[model samples]
Target chain A: MVKATPLAIDIHNLSLWYGDFQALFEVDLQVKQGLITALIGPSGCGKSTLLRAVNRINERLGDYVRTTGEIHVLDQDILRNDIELAQLRRHVGMVFQRPNPLPLSVRDNVLFAHRIHRADEKFNRRKEDEIVEHALRRVLLWDEVKDHLGREATGLSLEEQQKLCIARLLPIKPTVILMDEPTSALDPKGTAALEELIWELHGDYTILIVTHNMAQAKRASEETAFMLLGRMVEHGLTEQVFLAPREKETADYIEGRYG
Target chain B: MLTERVQLSTSIDLDHRGRDWYTDKAVTFLVFVGGISAIVLIIGIFVFITKEGLGFIAGSLDVREFFGSLAWRPTSPTKPTYGILGLIAGTASVTGLAMVVSVPFSLGAAIFIGEFATGRLRETLKVLVELLAAIPSVVWGFIGLSLLNPLIIDIFDVPVGLGVLNSGIILGLMAAPIMTTIAEDALKAVPDTYREAAEAMGATKWQVIFRVVLPAGRNGLVAAVLLGVGRGFGETMAVLMATGNSIKIPTSPFDSVTALTATIAAELGDAPVGSDHYRALFTLGILLFVVTFIINLTADLVVRRAGRK
Candidate 1:
């Protein structure tokens, strides 16, 4: 079954409502394995909502948010009621617009998920050090933070904080990562550094990102999906979607005629 | 460039010329007075209590006898004894018991109200718990007298129902509402971003609360518990009505005793005006004041530090 389908995430006819208001209407998307995909749209276009729904994080917003239809991650039906959130989330990680690192020491922040989900599992100092070093190095933060592993994660700069947030998710070995405009809070230098890092991890993990910057989508993603007013307007190869004239809405948005 | 030039040329002066200036100054003066009133009142109370309490301690009563000896016979004709050791022990034991009873339950209630409950249910639980705070201390005392007193006697098989145990239970219940409110506020004050981040990393509901929310709000939680301690320490009428008001150090929770606040409340009405007995009661007031002042000061420091973070 896994041989035939190379998709990491598949969504079908998904509709979401926030109380009386509908945020997403029959949105369908397919993210291939081992590639970076960007979802871009205006502020209220439900790009972030779509990203949140992939990992079911939107359920925490409140009970008023109602969702229907199916989301499958790595061929597992995640929308089913019996699906365990902890297990589902272990396979699908997320990064937010703001770098919300736990108010903990750098090492603890990296090991938080492993510590909680594997509560009964015992780890020696050597194993813990290996885990922290491996995860931090994956995000290229080990060099900057290795000397001060015991210091507070909140004390790091905004760029390092975002990288640490990404590193903290690595120990769980998630196959799919959903980023909700992860570099929005960083400066241009931080954004470029993070984009480079994301590019480096291009083929090892499937990444779906929500962004408002058209330039970021053009620069970073292999595939891009455009949404407007809770509908997926276009989905294609990043270059083709940007250059070729397809839908009028997509062209107008890409040409900067209107948001 | 055109817009910038227009904006620069058409800037409005915020410094109003006539009555508006006076209005701003008047409002500022009122706010200043309002802010300083609490400090002035506290200092006034300190001055009055210390002045009245200092006379007997300086002249007649030995410092050792006042603080060291446990015998508390203050009005005896032969030899008047005024050691407050017994009273201090009573207050300490009852406050300790109150903390033991209230902290766990109040924290549990706070977690439930802050994390688990939905909109209507959350609002309902909050209103109910806050209503617990609005219930008068005198009413709580009466409840202890009529309800808890009989229950205690039946359970422990004690001679009189009033004791450290009964008063401690009453004070704990009375303070739980306040503790829960403060703790819930602390828990809710943790930004939603932390919860989302933790949840996205596959943390279970309880794990997110215990590991992230609770630690982030630790200062507030400490402040809540300390404020509850202060409230328990300063509680007067409930302990007065429930504890047997005996002037002895209690060996067990079941034994009758008089808390410092109870001692002052119970004796202040009968003591003659401008007498040594009256002054000693004021001394007990000073002791209570100092302990609660220290507690409140620590709580303020914790809150301020948390704010800075």
Candidate 2:
């Protein structure tokens, strides 16, 4: 008997509109459990919009954004009217294009999500220290930042700041992590470092990353989905999509025909 | 090629000698005058006040008697006491009470306008709050005199409409717009990413505001409150009309009192030109200036530090 793979994010017929402009069409995609899935697209192709939709971050754009259809992350339909945004966000963490660390201490930034989501839980200083240290260590940032945990997170370099952003998400114990061009702000070295970190984090958590860099999608992701305009044109194993792309558009995009 | 180079050089010279150059010079001259005028006015006022009041500062303005004694009788034939303790206390009480009334309400309004309200509602509420500042101080005093006096009388059964409480309420109303406007600007200046990050961290609206936004905007809020305090302390007309000018240390908010501004407004005209009373009023003016200067300096320091962080 063949084993069936459980899906982490099951998105179906999802459409999003900003005012009169439709940003996402009827799109369907299934991201597998404990795998790195990359969404590749040209500029203004709704890659970020689709990524934000999984965690419902696009709702913060205000009432102008309208959505129809369903996005089920870990079997929960997050697009439902009765959904609690805070609860939904706790299940899914996001890292933005820029390394947006709050103007707070490194320790405070790492503790932020935990404090918010688990407000009722009893907190001890020792436990919190462990959580911060563990999260930082997982992101390979513990040694460099341990001595200056009280220093403002913004004081860190962009590379370390991006790592801290990822580290901050771990304490929340999110089921899926979404990255909207997470390494776009970093230099080449930083990008390579962050990609390695993301690869290391695979299998423990489902990560859906959006990238404009085709090489990054090929180098890091297990599965790849290509989007054009507002539609998911193709999705399959990363090697198949990049090496022998099924669609001419995906082939052209990967071959650097147009960005 | 030679003709083109010559033309380019001539055009550059013409650009330097253009009408925009004259306009720039004119603007520079006007701004320079505007900047120097404030300093000149301060110097002029300082010289005038000190020249008239110097003798009292030099001789009879005993620091102990001026500040320590409560009797403010300057017109008495036998004992012309110039003790301004009553005036200073009145100013402090009025300003302190005004801050008590204004701070929380203004902060609430600021937060509501800055964080809670949506597009049009936010803009409209901000404009309306700021419009409150445009209302003349005398008009506010008149409103308080006509509207609030009877209400206070009916509620508390106070003797007259005029007192520290009455003036403080009026002053608070006057200061609210300034506080709300500056504080709203401060809160709004907080980057949207902070809000997004907190929300994405599963924070509720109030939690984001109280924990993240307010902490980031603390310095601006402090500056706003200090500026409000300065406004309340230096206010003259509304306070003059509202607080019945009964020069004494007000034991309660209900008791009538005379602030330094009100004292100067009421007595300076009646006193002879160079009498000790005139000099005493000038001294009070100097005191008010120094106090306001210190408050403004503190506000500047706070704003600068906030920018650095």
Task: Give the per-residue lDDT digits (tens) of candidate 1, residues B76-111.
Answer: 778877889989988888888999989998999999
Q: lDDT values of the candidates?
A: 0.91, 0.91
Q: Give me the candidate number with maximum TM-score.
A: 2
Output per-candidate TM-scores for chain A, rounded to 2 decimals. 0.97, 0.98
Docking class of 1: medium
**Steric clash pairs (candidate 1):** none
Q: How well is each residue in A175-250 modelled by candidate 1, as lDDT tens digits?
A: 9999999999999999999999999888988999999999999999999999999999999999999999479999
Per-residue lDDT for A2-79 in model 2, tens only?
A: 437788899999999999999999999999999999999999999899999988888888899999989998788999
The CA-based lDDT of model 2 is what?
0.91
TM-score of chain B of 2: 0.91
Winner by DockQ: 2
Q: Flag clash pairs in model 2.
A: none
DockQ, all candidates in order: 0.70, 0.74
